[model samples]
Structure formats: C-alpha cells, structure tokens
Target: MRLSAYFMPTLKENPAEAQIVSHRLMLRSGMIRQQAAGIYAWLPLGYRVLRKIEQIVREEQDAAGAQEILMPTVQPAELWQRSGRYDDYGKEMLRFKDRHEREMLFGPTAEEMVTDICREIRSYRDLPKILYNIQWKFRDEVRPRFGVMRGREFLMKDAYSFDLDKDGARRSYEAMFRAYMRTYARLGMTAIPVKADTGPIGGDMSHEFHILAETGESAIFFDQELEEKSRAGELTVDSMNQYYAAAEEKHDADKCPVPAERLRTMRGIEVGHIFYFGTKYSEPMGAVVQGPNGETIAAEMGSYGIGVSRLVGAIIEASHDERGIIWPEAVAPFKLGLINLKSGDAACDSACEDIYRTLSEQGVEVLYDDRNERAGVKFADMDLIGLPWQLVIGPKGLAAGVVELKNRKSGEKQEVSLEAALARLTA
Candidate 1:
C-alpha cells in the first residue's frame, strides 16, 4: 500500500477522551475513530490489523479440529429463554421487539444459539464436532471506556464444541486449550493461563488467557518459572496449568502452593477465555443425540472465546513505546515500510520504487511512503505506524549506491547496496 494514496489520518495530538495508552495511540495513529462512548469505526488501517488477528485465531481454531461457521448476530430471544438466561443475562444484552412485536436481541454470547444448532445431530456418530465464527458482538456496558477495550460493539471469535460425554468433552477442551497457547505464542505475546470462575455460563472448568502489562487492569499472581517458560515458548496447556496462576481477585494467599520467593505478581489484560460448560445449554435446550441402544442424552459442551477487536487495543497495551505502537511481526498490518526519503529525486525514487516492487512481488506487505513530506515527518509517521523493517532511500544514499535499512524494534540502522537490502529483507 502506498501511504500517499492511503487514508491514514494520523493526529498530531492525542484525543481528549482516550484514557489508556492503547486508546490514545490508536487514535493518534489513525487506526480507529470513536463514533460514540465505547463505540468505534475501524478505519482502513485498523481494519487491516483486525483482520490479521482474526485470521490467526481462525487458523489456530481450525488446527484444533474446529470447523468455521458464522452464527447470527441477532438471534431469537426464545433460545435464551429456553436456556433460562433471557432475563438472567441482565441489561447488558441489547433486548428489543421486532417489527411484529416478537422478542429479539443482539447476542452478547452464542451458547443458546449454538445449542439450538446442535439439535440437528440425532445420532452418536456426530458425537464430536466443533463450530466457530469470527463475528461482531455487542454488550451494553454501563461505563464503556478505554476505547475498544470496553467497547459497546466489538469483533470476537467464539467457538463451541459438542461431544458424546464428559470424557469426550474433556478431550475437546484440551484441543482448544493447546490451540489457545499456540495462538498467543504466535502473536508475539506471552499469555499466561489463569484459573477463573465460570460465571453465568456455569462450568466446572475455565481459564482466561492474560497478557502481562504494566497498565493492565487485573493483578496476577503466578509461578515465576512458568512466566519465564511462557515467554521462552516452553509451555503447553498441560504443563502451564500444572503451575499456580490466577488473578488476584480469585487467588487465595494461604492456598497458594508456590513459595513466596517463587511467585511473581504483575498486572495483566485478559484477551482469551475457554470454558467447559457441560450440558448447561445442551440439556436445557434439548440438544440430544441418540445412543446405540436408542437412549437420548444431552451432549456435553464447551465454549471458547477470544477478544478479536479488543486485542487491537490489548496488543498496543502490551507492545508499544513512547513514539507509538510496536506491532508484533505476526499481527503487523504490513511487514516493511519503504520510504522515498527524497520523493522527487530520480535516483531515490527509482530505488524505492524498485525495492517496493521487489518486496511486493516476493509476497511481502510493504507500505511505501512516497509522499512529498519532510524527512522528520516521514520518519515520525513510519515510527508511529510501527512496521517491523523500514527501508530508507534518499539522494545521498543512492548517490553512494546504497539504501539505509532500519530495524524498527531495535532502532538499529545499516547502509547496504540495493541487492543486499532486498536479499536481507526477503530472507
């Protein structure tokens, strides 16, 4: 994408209402624009990042043997009523009446709707199946603040599993558990798995994935060794859950087995959650399958959710510096930022154009800054957007037969011949 033609409306000053680092940086970087309290319109740049995150979530879900299927955003209230949560879900659910005065609601969660779908499976052969979707969800927060972190409208990835019995359900849960760990690892974040209470969903097992950050909302107490292992990519669901990890709110000091010296405490942001809510929705909604002997039984079930839109803010909360967001390579909107330092100069322009073309042709996503902007302005904008690698081409560098390459994360620069730069970037 060419920055000159792109619709990135970066702000020189932070928006007045943004309280958190992610919210402020997102606004200043031209990623999202707030339309109302806790509601936002994802501009093009923001949308690109959102899609990238969603795709990663999708891939991991699929790898765990979950199939993709988009459920409706607006579902019949009757399903919730059958699950006995229509009224118990509280005002956070956007309840309403349709044209003919029938009850309807914008789904805050899809347990009820997914259970109704499982009603189609009539035999034990369909015992194990997982369905998932990445879609927009809404919940009317009483105090929706912190930009997309607590937004009224947001995108989410929710997946549900149906199994023959408790044992089968446990296996399904484990698959998702490992997948979640792999997902966070690929996103360039160390997400610790913390034990959690299954609130309205009513489950015997649950875990919330939290990314540690200084400005995070929840306080966490965990095994210091596990924290290090998670950062070093040495953790699997089985090994991670063996260690003690919990939010401070749910933690008991006396019950903790880890020695005080081995415990590490920090603030964290919740980005994903998984629950095994056996028979909660299925039993109530009559999602039954027939046994070989012809007995009907409610399928054991579980639900997993990842905050797709919230991760946009959560990522910034976890990864950023004074200048702006420092996107992890996996979720970065573009891989490289190619700057034509002197746009109109023939040598510089040709070199940048050739490099940009070569990178693009090599399946790399590059954002070329070919605008007639000052050096400082171009550098600032490039740093603000936070692409992983930046290739700077200027008249001086081209005259010397080299281009300047900078690693955004380390702030390290090197001048190399055009071929060398291209080879390094592609390699």
Candidate 2:
C-alpha cells in the first residue's frame, strides 16, 4: 500500500479526550476515530489490524476443536427469560422492543442463545460440541472510557462448549485454556490466567487471562514462579492453576498461600476469560440430551471469550513507547514500511520502488511511503504507525549501492546492499 493514496488521517497533536497512551497513539497514527463517548470508527489502518487479530483468534479456536458459526447481534429477550437471567442481568444489557413490540436485546453475551441451539440435541451422540462466533457486542456502560478497552460496542470471540457431564465439561475447559495460552504466545504477549469470580455468568469455575501493564485497571496478586514459567514457555492449565493467582477483589492477603518472598503484585488488563458453568444455562433452558442409561440429562457447558477488538488497545498499552505503537509482527497491519526519503529523487524513488515490488512479490505486506513529503515527516509517520521492519531509501544510500534497514522495536539501523537487504527481509 502506498501512503500517497492512502486514507490515513494522522494527527500532529494529542486529542484532549484521549486519557490513555493507546488511545492517544491510535488517534495520532490515524488508526481510529471516536464516534461517541465509548464507540469508535476503525479507520483503514485500524481495520486491517483488527482483521488480523480476528483471524488469529479464529485459527486458535479451530485448532481447539471449535466449529465456526455466525450468531446474530440481536437476540430475542425470550431466550434470556428462559434461562432465568432476563431480570438478573442488569441495565448493562441493552433491552428494547422491535417494531412489532417483541422484546429484544443487543446481546451482551451468547450463553442463552447457544443453550437454545443445543436444545435440539436429543441424544448423547452429540455429547461434546464447541461452537464459536466472532461478532460485535454491546453493553450500555454508565461511564465508558479507556478507548476500545471499555467500549460500549466492540468485537469479541465467544465460544460455547457443551458436554454430557461435569467431567467432560472440564476437559473442554482445559482445551480452551491451553488454546488461549498458545494464542497469546503467538500474538507476542504473556497472558496470566488468574482465578476470577463468575459474576452474573454464574459459573462454578472461572479464570481471566490478563496482560500485565502499568496502566492496567485490575490489581493482580500472583506467584512469581508463574512469570518465570510463562517466559520459559512452560505454562499449562494444571500448572497455572497450582500457582496462587487472584485479582484485587478476590485476593485475600491473610489467606494467601504464597510466602511473602514469592508473592508478586502488579496491574493487568483482562483480555480473555473462560468459565465452566456446568448446567447453569442448559438446565434452566431445558437443553437436554439422553444419557447412556437412557435418562434425560442437561448438558454441562462452558463459555470462553477473547476481547478481539479490545486487544488492539490492550496490545498497544502493553507494547508502545513514547513514539507510538510497537505492533507485534503477527498482528501488525503491514510487516514492513518502505520509506522513500527523497520521494521525487530518481535514484531514491527507483530504489524504493524496486524494494517495494520485490518484497511485496514475496508475499510480504509492505506499506510504501511514496508521498512527496520531508524525510523527517516520513520517518515520524512510519514510527507512529509502527511497522515491524523499515527499509529506508535515500539518494546517499542509493549512491553507495545500499539502503538502510531498520528494526522498529530496537531502533537499530544497518546499511546493507540492496541484495542483502532483500535476502534478510525475505528470510
């Protein structure tokens, strides 16, 4: 993609409404625009990153044996009523009536709807099934803030698992637990799963996956061993559960098991949550199947959720520096930024064009800065957008038969021959 014709509307000054680093950088980099107090319009650059994150979540869900499905954003209020939660779920759930006066709601979660679907399984042959959808959700927040992290409307990946018994449900929950760890690892993040209260979801077992950040809202108390294990890529559901981990509200300091030396406290932003609710929804909604003994039994169930759109902001909060966002390579909108320092210079333009074409041909996503702009302006914009790698072409570098390759995260640059640069980037 060439910046000359791109629709990125970057800002030079921080917006007064942006209270967080991610929000400020997102606006300055032209990734998103605020449409309301808690709603945002993802611009082209932001949308690309959003789609990339969604794809990763989809792939991980499939690998965990979950089938993909698209559920409607609007759900009938009757479903929640059948689950005995229509009145329990607070004002956060947007309730309304259709033109015909039928009670409806923009779904805040899909537990009831998914349970309704499972009601058709009359036999144990379909004992174990997992269905997931990546969709938009809404919750009428009283005071929405922190950009997409707490947006009223956002994208989420929610998966529901149905099993014949509590034991089977646990297995399904463990599978999703492992899948979540792998998903975060691939996205270049260390997510710690902490014991959490089920809240209105009404689950017997629950865990929230949080990414540690200084600006995070949740105060987390955890065993230091978990961090070491996470960094070593040795995290497992069983191993993680054995460690002492809890959010601020749930942490009881007097009852904590970890010794003073091993206990560590930090702030974290929640990015994913999983719950094994057993028959919470299934029993109430009569989602039953025949057991091996020919007796009717309610399906045991679990729900797993990942904040797909909120992750964009969470990642920025965890990874960005003073300049701008340092997007993880796996979720970066473009893998490389090709900057033509002298856009109109024959040699500079030719070098950039050649590198851009060759790298793109090799299936690399390259953002070519071919606008007729100053060198400093191009460099600043490239840093603000945060491509993983940058190829800088200038008359001086081209005259020397070389171009500069930069690592965005490390702020390191090396002058290498064009051939060498191409080989390194493609490799």
Candidate 3:
C-alpha cells in the first residue's frame, strides 16, 4: 500500500478525550475515529489490523477442532426466556420490540442461543461438538470508556461446546484453554489464565485470560513461576489451573498458597474468558441428548470468548512506546514500511521502486511512502504507525549504494548495500 493513495489521516496532537495510551496513539495514527460515546468507526489502517487479529483467532480455533459458523447479532428474546435469564440479564442487554411487537435483543453473549441450537442433537454420537463465530456484539455499558478496550459495540469470537456429560464438558474446556493460550502467544502476548467468577453465565468452572500491562484495569495476583514458564513457552492447561492465580476481588491474601517470595502482583487487561457451565443453559432450554443407556440427559456445555476488537487496544497498551504503537509482526497491518526520503528524486525514486517491487513480489506486505513530504514527516508517520521494519532511502544513501534498515522496536539502524538490505528483509 502506498501512503500517497492510503487514507491514513494522522493527527499531530493528542485528542483531549483519549485518556489512555492506546486510545491516543490509535487516534494520532489515524487508525480509528470515534463516531459516538464508546463506539468507533475503524479506519482503513485499523481495519487491516483488526482483520489480521481476527484471522489469527480463527486459525487457532479451527486448529483446536472447533468448527466455524456465523451467528446472528440479533437474537430472539425467547431463547433467553427459555433459559430463565431474560429478566435477570439487566440493562446491559439491548432489549427491544420489533415491528410485530415481538421481543428481541442485540446479543451481549450467545450462551442461550447456542444452547437452543444444540437442542437438535438427540443422540450421544453428536456429543463433543464445538462451534464458534467471529462477529459483532453489543452491550449497553453505562460508562463505556478507554476506547475499544471497553467499547459498547465490538467484535468478538465466541465458541460454544456441547458434550454429553460433565467429564466431556471438562475435556472440551481444556481444549479451548490450550487454544486460547496458543492464540495469545501467536499475537505476541503473554496471557495468564486466572480463576474467575462465572458472572451471569453461571458456571461451575471459569478462567479469564489477561495480558499484563501497567495501565490495565484489573489487578491480578499469581505465582511468580508462571511468568518464567510463560517466557519459556512451557505453560500448560494443567499448570495454569494448578498454580495460584486470581483477580484482586478473588485473591485472599491470608489463604494464598504461594509464599510471599513467589507471589507476583500486577495489573492485567482481560482479553479472553472460558466457562464450563455444564447444564446451566442446556437443562433450562431442553437441550438433551440420549445416553448409551437410552436415557435423556441434558447436554453439558461450555462457552469461550475472546474480545477480538478489544485486543487491538490491549496490544497497544502492552506494546507501545512514547512514539506510537509497536505492532506485533503477526498482527501488524504491514510487515515493512518503505520510506522514500526524497520522493521524485530520480535515483531515490528508482531505488525505492525497485526495492518495493522486489519485496511485494516476494509476498511481503510493504507500505511505501511515496508522498512529497519532508523526511521528518515521513519518519514520524512511519514510527506512529509502527511497522516492524523500516527501509529508508535517500539521495545521499542511494549515491553511496546503500539503504538504511531500521528496527522499530529496538530503534537500531544499519546501512547496507541495496542487495544486502533486500536479502535481510526477505530472510
């Protein structure tokens, strides 16, 4: 993508309304714009990152043996009524009436709706089925703030697993647990799964995956060893559950098992959650399957959720520096930023064009800045957007038969021959 043709309307100053680093950087980088309180319209650059994150979530879900399916944003209120939660869900649910005066709602979550779907399975052979969807969800937050991190309208990946018994339900939960860990790791995040309350979903077992950040909303306490294991890529579902990890509200210091020396406390932004509610919704909604003995039994179920849109902000909160967002390679909108320092200079233009063509031909996503702008402006814009690698070309450098390669995260630069630069970038 060429910046000359791209719709990145970057701002020079921070917006007063943005209280967090992620929100401010997102606005300055021209990734998103607020349409209303707690709602935003993702601009082109932001949309590309959003899609990349969504695709990674999709791929991990599929690899975990969960089949993908599209579910409606608007759900019939009867499903909630049948599950005995219609009146209890409270104001967060956007409930209303349709043209025929029938009750409906923009689903805040899909537990009841998924349970209704599972009601079709009559035999145990259909047990252990997991289905997921990546879609928009709406919640009427009384005070929606912190940009997309707590937006009223956001994208989410929700998966529901139905099994014949409690044991089967636990196995399904474990599968999702592993999948969630892998998903976060791929996004360049170290997510710690801590024991959590089941909230309105009403589950016997629950875990919330949180990414550690200084500006995070929730305070968490956990075993210090977890961090070492996470860094070593050795975290397992069993280890996560067995270790001492809890949210602030749930952590009882007196009863904590970890010694003070091994305890680590930090603030974390919640990005994913999983629940094993067993028959909570299935029993109430009549989602039953026949057992081997021919007896009717309610399907045990679990629901897993990852905040697809909120992750964009969470990642920024965890990864950005003073300049701007430092996007992870897997979720970066583009892998390389090609800055033509002297646009229209015959030699400079030719060099940049050749480099851009070579990289693009090799299946690299490069954003070439071919605009007639000052070098400082080009550098500032590129840093604000935060591509992993940047290639700087100028008349002086071109004349010397070399181009400057920069690593955004480390702020390191090296001058290498054009051929060498291409080899390093492509490698």
Candidate 1 C-alpha lDDT tens digits along 1-427: 9999999999989889989999999999899998888889999889899999999999999999999998989999999999999989998999999999999999898999989987999999977999998889999999999999999999999999999989999999889988888888889888888878898889999989998888899999999998888777677657876799988887899899999999989999999999998899998899999988899988999999999999889989988899888899999989999998888988888777888888999999999999999999999998998889899988888888988989988989999998998888889
- lDDT by residue (tens digit), candidate 2, 124-143: 99879999999999999999
- Point to the candidate with the largest lDDT: 3
lDDT (Cα) of model 3: 0.92
Q: Model 2 — which ten-residue stretch has the worst lDDT?
A: 228-237
lDDT of each: 0.90, 0.91, 0.92
The runs of at least 3 residues in candidate 2 whose Cα sits more than 4 Å from the true structure, single-residue gaps closed, are: 252-255
Q: Given candidate 1, what's the lDDT at residue 263?
A: 91
Which tens-of-lDDT digit does each residue in 300-391 have in candidate 3? Answer: 88999999999999999999888898999999999999999989899889888888899999999999999999999999999999999999
Worst 10 residues of 3 by lDDT: 228-237
Error of 3 at 232 (Å): 3.6
Error of 2 at 23 (Å): 1.0
lDDT of 3 at 239: 79
The TM-score values for the models, in the order shown, are 0.97, 0.97, 0.98
Question: If both were scored by lDDT, which would come out higher, candidate 1 or candidate 3?
Answer: 3
lDDT of 2: 0.91
| Model 1: colliding residue pairs | none
Q: Model 3: how large is the Cα RMSD against the reference? A: 1.2
